[model samples]
Target chain A: MKPSEYDFVAARRRLEAKEKSAGEKLTSLEDAAARVTNGDVVAVGGILFSRTPMALVHAILRERRTGLTLVRNLMCQEGEFMMAVGAVERVVTAWFGIGLPWGVSKIMREHVEGGKVVYEEWSHLALGLRFRAAAMGVPFLPALTMLGSDLVAIGPMKTVIDPYTGTTLAAIPALYPDVAILHVHRADRFGNCQIDGYPHMDADIARAASTVLVTAEALIPDEEVRRHPDRTVIPGFLVDAVVPAPWGAFPHECYGLYEADFEHFDEYAAAIDARGTAGVTEFLDRHVYGPASWLESLELWGAERLARQARRAHELVPATDIMGGLSTPPKPPALGAPRQSRGAPRPPDAFTGYA
Target chain B: MTTIASPTEWLAVVASRQLRDHTTVFAGVGVPLLAAALAQATHAPNLTIVVEGGIVGPRIKPGRLPISTNEMRTAYRATMLTGITDTFLLAQRGALDVGFIGGAQIDPYGNVNTTVIGDYARPKVRLPGTGGANDIASLCRQVIIVTAHERRRFVPRVAFVTSPGWLDGAGGRERAGLRFGGVSGVVTTLGVFGFDPTTRRMRVDALHPGVTMDDVRANTGFEVLSADGIDTTAPPAADELELLRALDPERRFLG
Candidate 1:
């Protein structure tokens, strides 16, 4: 093959063309998640609160796909949402944010207690290594971290003791997910995706999965992606299906498009606080159910509807949205002072002026 | 008896204790990130917090938050640029003092299972497997296991060995002549634990204020012996809390 034809860029382009099958599109998030089978190791991408494919979570809940093993960089509220709905079998993640706002609540705790779920924690770097392994198709990379410490005791799930070195190197096997679900800011019709901000390892995850389902806020033409391929995070070849599911990210923002609807999230969290899952389910039904797009759902739950929901739920404005309590690290009062009394935190209203 | 406190306080207190002056602490993301910052702010003022991306002595503004490793901006004071593998080399060479980590499953033997919940060949769940953890766990002079302590987490045996703290026993570690540093203690929200010098298995060393040994025993899945008389961990004073908040101004670490 000619150098021009066999180059990485050309190879990528050819692969993308082959991956894009005509008439391959997801009807909805439910249909998308239903395609995944039980006992499949899946990878989903998102950071702490941004860029989560919330539509996919709704779809999984609607279809009730259970016994899934999820491998991801971070598992927070969205991961907990699956666990809460009894959809996830086991989850391996670096760090799981605890507390109510992030969805690490009674249900997640129940699953952990019931032995239905296995939680794996690691340093973020370790988490990144597994993604790199999956991306590179390596069996397992050599690692020296947590060798003699308690961390070594936890996740290496695979171990090959080196006879020569007499040192244990935890062999963290590569993860090849059945499907890698990614929600991004933009994509071409051929499923070439781009991350406007911090991509958070989604591209590597897409490479590691058997099939890739990409949901983007908007779909630009293939030519546009071709024009600036470097901006494209996922080459089209890795993608199996592309759905222009606007507001697919929902609670999570799609960078530059819209700020996270912290108010709506707050409403959802309030419902969770007041009536637990029932309230959250109702919130999901109102905002995330049906064929209507997220934009439509947001319109339906505009200021008036949310206000009514907030009043009816009898919960204060969700805590996650109202950021006025400014509890930052106190500045040194001069060069050195022991510290002032950290008594009862000042009321949120005290910083209302700042808000 | 003292009650273990919130996650933020837990991170701040651990960081305050472990970090020392002029030491180079390799920082991973999450709690380790938090602890490194706290150590730099409190005890180890000159401490160089080296991240895997190769930044050092991060000019951490006063905060209870961890700076992002992916941010090229955070790599300012870094002496060199390297991948996750190189960071472990630094640890292996005794270039590190204290390291912070968390795990999914921890056994009495301090054998962690971050890989799977079942057998190695056929796992109930395959997590994003190990990275520098194996190296950091083995090489760091002392490693601190930071995670919320629950019954499922503290198990009798880990499903897979992600990292080995004490290994089968302390004697086993000694006999094998492992160059990697052995586990010193486990810091959890509820209490702190250390391996018996002889058995190499974990024993309760201290409990956080507002927590009891009974609570620790109830939460732990294994049979853990308590220290002759365990003491309570100090609660984060105002300064500590302030420092923590500064690190994560948005309280992203709280949830």
Candidate 2:
């Protein structure tokens, strides 16, 4: 093939226009849901329901989309809520429910028992590693987790041996989701998102999916996005759409946002225990389907509850609280208390030596 | 009127008593949190509590229990924020001394069954599958098996082996190539059980206060092994109950 004539001046103008069109990335939740198709494997971010994109998910549910494969880590309220709304067909990940003495949620258990959903469980490491593999464009990730367990036999996981050593190893095939939805503390119109606290696996999921939709608590100015430039977790080019949804993570913590609504979760769990699947629907109808939008749903919680639960990052200056509420230790633990197990955490390979 | 102790309260204290100094405990939530918190405050103040999500040594807040190990509270004051790979790598290297596990059923050999109740392909009841519990049970140097003591849960043979405790009656775990760990204790609402040294089978080490040997045998599906002399467990001290309640003020997980 012969090279064609290049137009440098016009190309430069187009690049400048693209950079200035940052506001174009901002869209409504309805438009974000429009990007989702039935049967799409959706990667939902947030660990244990903390910092989930509630508005985006509610909008997606209103569209009446079903048969979607959900990739998740914790089976918290999001999994159960989706199941009640008929938004999921299968779940691939580890853990559902809080564990005994409460046990897994009745809704999740009933769905599995009725064969409404297939549960493919994996170790947290294996699940996360697979997402990283997909993000890196690899076929599989070799890991040491689930090596001598039954999850490998029943799920997509398999055993591969090192040809040189003849030692068996576990592998999780890459999971490239069609869409990834994440909720973050803040982001600019350009989709440069900042996750205030623990980013369980959002970075990996966003990179692995073909399209990334972010629902942020606030859409800040370009300066705020670049303030701590090096701390930028999600790069703008990777994002497909961004929505500003306040209280985006309801019934769960959002770091400097608000405390996890333990009151509601308890009520939901008890309702399920008392009425089984029927209880799940009642809670959903009242809280989920009934609301016209995420902000409107705030009326259900009332202003007093929200104000009481509000947790600002500055309040917890030295340490980041999970629920954003303040907590003072009963007593400062003895600094050099007789050492236990000499296994105090060592710095990771990446963080070390750089110092 | 003085209130009677609930099973959860009794079990948490009984489980916490098992902790000794200089031991790393692995568990996620519920009784494990209550027990670990109680131990850290009262007896073993220096205990290093490890969560599966790679959060190690967090000063767990008393009034709030994180929903899962994945929650940021688990990493609140954690000295090391290693992910699952590093946490398990440390476990495989024989760092953890005690691992706490919950199960649906347990056989005499201590093989845990959390997969299904009746059949393999089609089960009458399907449980949420293992989430690194298999590794916790397989790799830790010792494990504290916490579960109900119903005839249904204490079975003759588990339907499926989700986490290996002890394979047949003898050297099954060793035969399977597990590098470290075995069932050191089984903490139940009724009593505590330890494995036989020579036979490697579970036997009653001690019974909780007010529990009878016949009661333990009746609740268990399999034969309840007992030695010539079995000790009785002491009741929870007044302070222990006070601390346990502090760890879970709202009874969020305990209830």
Model 2 reaches an interface RMSD of 3.0
Q: Model 1's CAPRI class?
A: incorrect
Native contact fraction, candidates in order: 0.17, 0.26
Candidate 1 lDDT over residue span B145-241, tens digit each: 7778889899887767777767777565554345557777788878778888877778888787778878987998888987798887777776776
Q: For residues A173-275, could you state the per-residue lDDT of candidate 1 as single tens digits?
A: 5665667888876676667777653456787788767778777765655565666677777877567777666556645544333334456556666776788
**CA lDDT, every prediction?**
0.60, 0.71
For each candidate, give the TM-score of chain B. Answer: 0.88, 0.95
Which structure among the candidates has the greatest DockQ? 2
- lDDT score, candidate 2, position B250: 90
Question: Model 2, A210-288: lDDT tens per residue?
Answer: 7789987656667655656765688887788998776677767666456666667777778888888778778778776
